[model samples]
Target chain A: MKLEILAALNAEREARRAAVLVTEIATGKQRLVREADLASDPLAETLAERLRMGKSGMAETPAGDVFLTVQAPPVRIVVTGAVHISQALAPMARLLGHDLTIVDPRTAFATPERFPDAPVHAEWPDDVLPKLGVDRYTAFVALTHDPKIDDPGLIHALRSRCFYIGALGSRKTHAKRVERLTAAGFTDKDIARIHAPIGLPIGAISPAEIALSIMGEITAALRLKPASAAQAAA
Target chain B: MLATDNDIMNRAEAWRREGKGVAIATVVETWGSAPRPVGSHLVIDDDGNFLGSVSGGCVEGAVVTEAVDVITSGAPKMLEFGVADETAWKVGLSCGGRIRVYVERVD
Candidate 1:
């Protein structure tokens, strides 16, 4: 409730940075815990775990019970393709509480009419990806089958630590695509991050179904950790 | 309209600035069959009016009922509810799940 604390919390929200307000349940003492400051907090271990999950909760600590009210920025999905699947995906991502931007070099397909809600960039990835400012909270999906556009987008996405990167292509096509990326200087680990054929396999045959599957897969990728890590956390 | 978490926080701060007491109820933890995820929030004013939801249909009434007291007493409280617990079932947490909620008066 201090004026300084209030200003700091509001500033973080304005900047769309993730922060947690830690409250001491016993004495009503409190402090703001920005994601950047987690490493130095006394409750660093639990704070990092909760911040990764991006949830507010009561944490039992040696000091006492502390309630962490997390303020995480909304996730943004950067898509390179303004095809039919993107038409379905733009709205779908918004409904799932994600902010999305679609980039396509084709002005004909990347029209405001097709995506009334999301921003459409009729420019190449090389020109647009930097403008979008993809970050750790950003998810990159290349729905455009054109290697020229999709490959460059993947390179930019991999250069940073965007949480998810998926590309649309069949397994055979993806193998060839991997070869191309490898030759272009991506390591196997970086290539492994791409969800080739993109989306969870729910027998998606329609554009809408495929969009739904892609969102589902992205949600799983964000919320569900690997089995071994999950067990360790438990 | 559904209020986002920031909306709830901002609104609570605005209400306080306007001299109206505010209390926030947040879902801190949940077990099986929890309809809402942890960190979901419902904010209430001194008048018992509220925005957002803590549970789809469970434990909300009790949480709000306590928020009024929180606004008056300026004390924070933590509550737990579960279907197996008879007291929780009486309070409408009959969703075959367990949830812990922490309510505090936000100044």
Candidate 2:
């Protein structure tokens, strides 16, 4: 790859945009295909599939064998609560190679000492999330159990393309929350996007176990087929 | 600090900007239980300094050594490591997985 191509690829990554580096094995000819240009590319369908999978592999075309380096944006986890569950989820998210941030309006809960690894924002989610720019690669989790904090964050997430939106609550609690969102003008289809009682059903009692379950659900939402991911989330 | 793939690529660009001969090796294909994924990268400088892993330390020494040569030659090379290859015994993946690494110099 040329230095210019490498520089451009790095720029795209810095901007958190997805791109593919296509390199021909035989000739070493290469080009960087930005996500915006995919629709017109010759390998649009294949590239789109690889980009969705976020995997790099070899593809055989009439030109010969080419390697597609699918550079998807790094997954980001934005938790609305810096509570016990968020504490447990922080390191796990980091271990799984996901960027994690803790947002809590309550200063006592959101503290740097509490979250040594992840960034803790002691501000309202509405004030912080817009700056974070939660994109499709982001996993938005509402764990505050406080509608005042989590509701606004959920509204932002619903407006954005974040892949996963999970809210930690009981079935009864979610039912009430659903009513509130419905009154807020969200239809059943839009409100259905949230994975209520957040996390996979694993009979988790401890906060750490709950964190594990949440991570599992997020992984399923990210890696599994969309239809199966919805079932898994359910 | 653990260096992510993004960090590795950024370091490669920084090394090039410093006028150091840099070569980047990427795992293009893998079979069986390969330690690293296909998109994993290992960036090396002319002095054999490298960051990141193509095989989680199993074949990095070989990849780094070959990367130095690619930096000097300015030509790309495809390296394969597996239980089936003779060199696997020297720098083989203990997990018995096959991986194809493409090493190219950054001009």
Candidate 3:
């Protein structure tokens, strides 16, 4: 029984998935809790409530004994340009355990020779992006600086609910791009989703500095607390 | 008995027991002009161990001292050192930033 429990814990950790083991420690009623959906998991629901209340340690359970283990998955970064900034950004993103992919229709730019260790896709955005299936866990960046390449990618990214959609450009260029997007029927709200002039206002001049600013902005976007929720929490 | 810290230690210990060498690095706190934030950690093993950060390079000597003790005794410790200390100037942290780092041997 102990070996079985250990094995389950190991498997969950290996998969990088969260699990809760509900056991009646006093009564020795041990039941492994696995729910298809997190919301439906009673043990997880209870544990989350307890955590929110800042409570820990053994808790009485109607069942037997229960322990919750959570393993967070690594983040993913999908760069839609094989530009110079991407050459620097990809390595840093990889160090942070972000699975990165570089897509560009320009085969010369997207070749592995340019991005030695990255996954390169030498295909058009419309052809390549849908197969990748961007998700909420994914961060998409349109760094091509050319609307012909960046626009279709941004449209795809915005439609798929990616967590971050960043486009590299000047303020004037972005304004012009927005006009084009609006003409194409994207609502203001959809346009607002983009992080144009993508990086932080760090006055970055070089490609590496620009990459750093973009990374910093992406990190902030990921970690920043929602302003609307502060009032609600207060 | 913080569950998060305990869990992290347990995992490190398990790796050590399986022939993996472990070193724990802690961030005590940050004052000014620190590269890594407070509470950032770098863990290293026998081959130059690292996990978290103490201060970019300013107070690494003090952190290494605690780390060596942890490797020998398998005990945890809270080490505090900052620019206010006399030695901080020698470590190149005289820039007015201070940090406290806690190093432990989880294995």
Assess every candidate by TM-score. 0.85, 0.88, 0.60
TM-score of chain A, cand. 1 = 0.86
Per-residue CA lDDT of candidate 3, range A1-234, in tens? 133553554465445344444434343344445433446666666855532332223455566534332323335688889999999998877666566889999988998988975899999888889988775556789999889999999889878756678999889999999999999899998888788889899999999999899888878766573221211232
Indicate the residue-level lDDT of B50 in model 1. Answer: 85
Q: Write model 2 residue lDDT over A138-190, tens digit each, in one string.
A: 89999989999999999999888788999999999999999999999998988
Candidate closer to the true structure by DockQ (higher is better), 2 or 3: 2
Q: Give the Å error, residue A38, model 1.
A: 3.3
Please count the clashing residue pairs in each candidate, in the order shown.
0, 0, 23
Per-residue lDDT tens digits of candidate 1, residues B35-89?
7888888888888888778778566778889999988898888888777465433
Sort the predicted structures by lDDT, highest score first.
Answer: 2, 1, 3
Instruction: Arrange candidates by TM-score, descending.
Output: 2, 1, 3
Question: Tens digits of per-residue lDDT for model 1 on A129-183?
Answer: 9877887778899999999989889999978767889999999989999999899
Predicted complex 3: CAPRI docking category: incorrect
| Candidate that scores best on lDDT | 2
lDDT of 1 at A171: 94
What are the C-alpha RMSDs, in order, of all predicted structures?
Answer: 3.6, 3.2, 8.3
Summarize candidate 2's per-residue lDDT along B1-107 as a digit string, tens digits.
Answer: 67887779999999999999999999998999999988899999999999898988888999999999999998999999986456435778889899999999999
